[model samples]
Target: MEHIYLLALVGGGLIGLSATLLLYTLGRIAGICGITFSLFMPQITDKKWRITFILGLVSGAFLIHLLTPIAIPAAPTDNIYLLIIAGLLVGFGTQLGNGCTSGHGICGIARKSPRSIIATITFMAIGFITVFVLRHIWGVI
Candidate 1:
């Protein structure tokens, strides 16, 4: 139990530290969806930093797995189609919200943006409603 708390603390600290560093060094927000979407659209001036940031994210995850060997939580379902649908929905939702959870809930909120505050609240409410519908009404989760 204490290990779980320690892990959470460490994980959260890393997130905050990374976000702060990105802001101070690059004058950028550490938004995963925004970072990824930049690869698609034309005329991105600073592509290297975005690519490096993404690589660092992936490498960090791999390094953490190598070091700690934590067990990944099992998915709610094993169906490939279900996973695809969920992924697409998430992508669409992020675009609809103008940012993902990381942008709105973490970086934006930390910077005290009003739009981020409202967006985060809306998403969290919708998430709770969706979970209730899935777990209680439909028994999905």
Candidate 2:
């Protein structure tokens, strides 16, 4: 139980460190959605760094999953169409909000950006409502 807490602490610290480093070195926000969205844009001149950043994210997670005793949680449902719809909804929400949780909740709030703060609040509120609807109201989960 204590090890789980330790793992979470270390993981969170690493995330903060990486976000800080990315901002300091590249003058860019460590927003996963924005990074991924920009990856497909042909006109973006800094594709190399973006590719490297994304690869680092993937490899880092793989390494942690491989090395750690922690078991990654399974998704609630295995329905492919439902999963696809959920993903699309999330992507649309991110676009509408201009950033995802890591951007608005972590980096944006840390930087004290008003828009990010509001967006993060809205994100959390909607997330709570969605979970409630899925689990309690509709019993979907």
Candidate 3:
């Protein structure tokens, strides 16, 4: 348990450090959703950088999986339709909020952006309510 906590702290610190470094170096916020969404924007002048950045994310994940025999628990079983609906809801929420967890929760909160703070709080509240409704109130899952 202590090891897990230590690993989590290290991982979170690395994420924060990397995000800060990216922001400092690129003069762009380390909001992954924004970076990814920018790919479709007409004014995206640096496509190669975006593509390489995205590729690095994928490659990094693959490298971690290969280097560490991590235990990824099986996803909780749930109704397929409900799962799809939830996914769509989350997508809509991210769009409406102008960012997702990585954007608001990670980088935004770290920088103390008021807008991001509100969005993060809202996102977490919604998540908590949804889980409560599904598991306790409605017994959906």
Candidate 4:
């Protein structure tokens, strides 16, 4: 648990630093969903930045694996149909929310946006309720 905490701290600091640097240098928000979505849009003129950003994300994770001994979590025990439905629900939620956890929780909240605060709270509460329903109420643990 202590190791997990330390790892999370390091990962979070890296994310925050990367977001700040991107914001300072590019005059843009470092929201991955926004960045990624922009890449697929027909109006995107310069694709290099988006490609590089995604590559950096993948390479950074690869570098972390090279430097650390983190183990991958086991595959979900839930049925594939259920997982697909959950994924679709999450995607819909993300679209409806206008941003994801990292976008709203990290960047938006950091900027002191009231909408982000509410969105983050709702996201977390829903997550907590889902876990409680799964593990306790539904006995799915």
* Alpha-carbon local distance difference test for all models: 0.89, 0.89, 0.82, 0.85
Which residue pairs of candidate 3 clash?
Answer: none
Model 3, 2-66: lDDT tens per residue?
98899899888878887888888887667777778778888988877778878988887788778
Deviating ranges (above 4 Å) for candidate 2: none
Q: How accurate locally is residue 115 in candidate 3, as Cα lDDT from 0 to 100?
A: 92
Residue lDDT tens for model 1, 57-134: 999988887888786566578878878888998888887788988898899999899999999999899989988998
Residue lDDT tens for model 4, 32-69: 77777777789988778878998999899888778878
Candidate 3 global CA lDDT score? 0.82
User: Could you give the C-alpha RMSD of every candidate to the true structure, in order shown?
Assistant: 1.7, 1.7, 2.0, 2.0
For residue 116, give model 2's deviation from the true position in Å. 0.6
Error of 4 at 81 (Å): 1.6
Per-candidate TM-scores read: 0.90, 0.90, 0.86, 0.87
The TM-score that candidate 2 achieves is: 0.90
Query: Which of candidates 2 and 4 is the stronger one according to TM-score?
Result: 2
**Candidate 3: minimum summed lDDT over ten consecutive residues — where?**
70-79
Candidates sorted on TM-score, descending? 2, 1, 4, 3
Record all residue pairs in model 2 with backbone atoms less than 3 Å apart, i.e. clashing.
none
